[model samples]
Each structure stands twice: as structure tokens, then as C-alpha cells.
Target: MTLLAFLGVALLVVLAGSRVAFYGDALAEKRGWGRTWVGLILVAATTSLPELITGSSAAFQGLVDIAVGDVLGSTLFNLFILSLLDAVSGRVPLLGRLHPGHALALGFSLLFLALQGAALWWGGPLLGPVSWYAPAAFFLYLLAARLTFLYEKRRSLGQEERLARLYEHLEAAQVVRGYLLWGGLVVAGASFLPSLAERLAEETGLGAGFVGTAFVGAVTSLPEVVVTLSAARLGAFDLAAGNLLGSNTLLC
Candidate 1:
């Protein structure tokens, strides 16, 4: 029954998360923010909210193992999903269509991971609530975002008037409606994760890290899988790739 409940809740998350792609795509078109920006930050962040919630809640409850495991496991699992997306992409190669800005994101992500690893290896000092890695990661994330913004700006030159018109015609009301409706559902579904993961860990006699990496990790990431596959099905390759890559990068 517990396992079934886990599956049921995971399904809800997927359903709620899948709709994010549709609304995100529409917002990108209406705002002319382009797929890179929407997929990397907006849609990715929204879909990844479950992890944010799960991690924070687990930490608050003193389940540091689960919190750390979920982040690491989800990052790897998200990358694995990219391979699955490639398989189902039909004639077009999914990775071939991605923007070059993703390289910067990947680089920054690796650098952050390396910092965490170094801290772990050498036992780096803490900064109150977290280790030194925390603030460092934030700074690197900011730099990554800035670099991406500049890259997009350079690539989209001379389209200011068109972008202005796109902005003028933006469907603010409907977009907010969609985000609120789906976003609420996502939050509701995600809220169940911490307790469920704890129960599952206890029932299975697995370490929190192992269970978090295997079960909770996959469960929370179902949203990304659903959204990415849905985007791929519709030939929204950039959005699809960006969502996965961005989610993976942010997982650190």
C-alpha cells in the first residue's frame, strides 16, 4: 500500500509537471524570451521545485543524508533521461539542436560539483547554515546566468522591435492562470514527498542516501521526464534539451 501510494503521488507530480511544458512554451512564444531562457530557468526551475521543497524539508527535519542523496541522484538521473529523450526523438538528434550557452552552464555546474567534492575530501569550513560550498555555488550560479544572458543577447541582435511587439502582445492573464493552476497542483503533490520518502526508507531498511538516490530521486524527477518527452514529441528540441540540462545543472 505504501509503494502504491508512492506511485500514485509520483503520477500526480508527472501530470502536473507535464502541463508546465505546454504553458512554458506558450509563455516563451508570447514573451519572445526564446526557448533557451524559458527552458533553462523558468520551466526547469518550476519542474525542479519538488526537489527544492524536498531537500529543504529534509534538511529542516535533520535528514541530511536524504537531502544530499536526492540532489546527487537527481542530477545523474536527469542526465540519464536525456539519453532516453534522444532515443525517442525520431529522426532529429536532440543534442544537436541545443544552444552553445549550455556549455557554460555545464562548465559552471561541474565547477560547483568540484567545489563540493573538494570540501568533502578536505573537510572545508562551514559558513553558518551551510558549508563554504553554499555561497560559492550561489555566486557561480549567478555568473552562469549572466553569461547565458549575454550569449542570448548577442545571438538575438537587431530583433528589438519584434521583441517589443511580442512583449506588447504577451498573454499575461492566461499565462498566470495556467501557472497558478498547475503550480498549485505541483506543490500539493510535492508536499507529500518528505514523509513518503522517510517511510519508504524505514520500511525498506535502506540507508537514507540509498533510498533517496533510488526511489525519491526518480519520483521527484518524474516531472522532468514527462515534460522533456512531451517537448521532444512536439519537436521542441531546444526546450526539451534545455529543460533536462538546466535541471541537471541546477541539481548541484
Candidate 2:
């Protein structure tokens, strides 16, 4: 029964995510936001939502290694996803338009790993006193954005912006209906899903933490791969490269 409920909730998360992606692609079309930027800034984050949940829970539960390992390992996989995007794009030369800014993302990602390493080492066995590592990740996000601006300015590349899908499915009535209503549904759903995942570990001896950290983690990360490959296949190398690498930098 527990596993059954979890499966149902998992189905909902996937369904909600698919709706979000469809509306998101349409939203991008209406606004003239190029596919790459929309995938990076909006789509990537939404798909990574499961990671944020599991990673945060692991961190909050003092499973620092699990939290750190998941991000680190997932990032390596993200790189694999990028390499796959480049390979499948068949955009010739393979190194074609491999944006210098993406190199910057790799550098930032290295720095993030360094910080996480230092925090865990210096903070002792618990890795909690250095919980500031989480917030510090945001500062790194700011730095990435700043570097992006500089990169584009140097190369004369224009700043890109995408349309908000909120304008569509979301309405004034929905907004006025209050956070307690829709927000509650989202939160309830959120709370329901992860706990269901947790329950799987409890009942099945499969270790929810590991399943959530890995199996589910890989599942959630797929949308980025799909969008990215689609963009790359279209010969949008820089945009595809930028979305994956840039998102890795921000999320890490």
C-alpha cells in the first residue's frame, strides 16, 4: 500500500512536470525567447526540483555525504548529458561554438566542489556548522550571472530572456484565490511525494535516501537532457551548451 501510494504520487509529479514543460515550450514560442535560454533558466530548474527536495532533505537530516555525493555525482552525469548532446547534435567539428562561457561554467563548478569539500572537511563529522554552504551556493549563482554578463559583453552577444509560463495557466483568480489554496496543493503534493519516497525505503529496505538520491535523481534530471539534446540537434550549439553548463554552475 505504501509503495503503491508513492507510485501514484510519483506519477503526479511527472504529470505536473510534463504540463509545465508543454506550457513552457509554448510560452517560449510566444515570447520569441530562444529555446536554449528558456531551457536553461526555466526548464532546467523545474526539472531539478526533485533534486532540491532530496538534496535539501539529506542535508537537513545531517546526511551530508549523501547530499554532497548526490550533487557531485549528478553533476558528473550532467556532464555526460552535455557530451551526449554534443555528440548527437551532429553539428560537425564537435567543438563548434563551444562557448567560452561554458568553460567559465566548468570553472565555477570546480569552485563549487571545492567549497563543498572544504566545508565538509573543516566542519567535522557532522558538516552542519558549515550549513552556510547552502546559502553560499546562491552567491556563486550571482557570480555566474555576473560572469555571464561579462562574457556576453566581451563577445557582443545579447542578453536573453524568456517568457513566464505563469501568464498562461495561472490567472488573476488563481492569484487572488490565495496562496493557502494553490500553494497548499503544491506544498501538499510536495510533502506527499518525498515522504512517499521515504516510505519506500522504510518498507522495502531499499533505502529511500539512496533511491531518492540516485534512481529518482536520474529520472528527474532527464528533462534537461531532452531539452538540451533537442536544442543541440537543431544546431543551436552555444544555446544548448550554455543551458546545461550554465544550469550546472547555478545549481551546484
Candidate 3:
């Protein structure tokens, strides 16, 4: 296929992936989860699912260069997402709240990169935290999720819950079913994403890292980019901006 054709396919993947993530968030919301919970955990994880799947697949396929490229691409693209959020929100100061989940995620993201570098220097495929790191990170992620959920629940129950008056074009049942269905789709779609990326990178001769960061990264981040834009258009400013900041934390 032509480079243009490959680009088109990648774009389509991002669009589909974005919708899938929105479905997941909508499902969580329909289940009585507040916006923060939906944005932070549900939407955030689902949105980033593309990256994880692609990276793991590349590594498994012995496309280590592709794997590294995709991670770097995801990081760059995720930052672009953050910059868009900043421009849209006009400096709402997401970091000022000192949210524990954000803090933890930021810390882990840095540690993830730093340790991975150290591992490479020492001739390892992976890095620190021993054999227990993934599980430990998972545990911490869960705890942070619980705390965020509680915070949102309490916030909505109080005077802090204020809608941006931007609700539009929603289906209750469809959204409700989204959680499980979208999650499954992410697993399946992500499975294909990296291979697609690998082919595209090799075909274009653009180098694995750059292509992965721009193409794969943008493709995986499709959800947040679209959602944030939609939120801005619909006047759900907080949700739009929140999704950006929240997604960035997860990406990191």
C-alpha cells in the first residue's frame, strides 16, 4: 500500500479506537461512576490500551526496535495531546490540585523510563522493581482508582458538582454496554495495532521510533484527542480538559 494509504488506515484506527474508549467511559458513567472516575481510570486506561498492546506485541514478535519506537511515539503523541489540552483549557492548572493518582502516575512514568534505560545499559530487555513490579504497580493503580472514585462520589454529593451544561447525543443503553464491549475491542484492536505500525514504518522508511511515536502514538491516543475536542465543542470544558490531564498522567 502507498504511504498515504497506510496513513489513512492508521487514522481510521485512531478514530475507531477513540470511539471505543468513549464507549467504555460512557459505560462507566451509566453505571453511576462520576466524571472524574470515568476520566481518570476507565477512559484513561482504555485510551492507553493501544500503546500497551502494540508495545507488547512488537516485543513478542522480536521487533524490539518497533517496540521501543512505539513507546517513544506514544510518549511524544501523548505530549501533543497534553499540549492540545493546554491550548483548549487556557491553563486550568490540573497539576495544582496535588491529586494523589496523578502524582503516583507521574512518579511511575519517570521511574519506568529511567529504569528501562538502566536496564538497557546493563544489557537487559526490561528493568527494575524485580519480578514483582508489574503486580505492585497494578496494586498501586487499583488503590489510586479506589481513592479517585471515592473523591468523585463525595464531590458529586456536595456542592462541588457542577455540570458544564454540554450534554448531547447520548444513548443510555449503548453507553451502558460500552464498558465490557469496548474493553474487549481494545484488546483485539490493540493486538493488531503494532503489527500495522510495524508494516507502516518499514514501508515508509521513516524509522521505527518516529513512525511509532507519531503514527502509533497518535493512533492509540485517538480517544482522548477526539474526546477533548468534542468536550470543548459541546461545552463540557472541564471534562474535556480533565480527560487530557488524566490521560497524560496515565501515559506518563
Q: Which candidate tops TM-score? A: 1
Model 2 steric clash pairs: none
Best-to-worst order by TM-score is 1, 3, 2
Q: How should the candidates be ordered by lDDT, best one leading?
A: 1, 2, 3
Q: How many clashes show up in model 3?
A: 1
For candidate 2, the 10 contiguous residues with the lowest summed lDDT are 157-166
In order, candidate lDDTs are 0.73, 0.58, 0.56
Instruction: State how far residue 164 of model 2 sits from its true place (Å).
Output: 19
What are the RMSD figures for all models against the true structure?
Answer: 3.8, 6.5, 5.1
lDDT of 3 by residue, 154-222 (tens): 544332323312123556776666555645554555555555665676677754565445665565665
Candidate 1 residue runs with Cα over 4 Å from true position: 1-8, 155-170, 197-213
The whole-model C-alpha lDDT of candidate 2 against the native structure comes to: 0.58
Q: Residue-wise lDDT of candidate 2 within 5-49, one digit each (tens)?
A: 866765555444444444444444444443444454555565555
lDDT of 1 at 22: 69
Residue by residue across 1-252, what tens digits does model 1's lDDT show? 777887788787778776777666666666556666677777788778778788887889999877877787788888788888878777767667666767776677688778877977887787786788778777877777777666766555444454445446547778768866886777687778656865876788763565445666666776788888877776666678778777766778
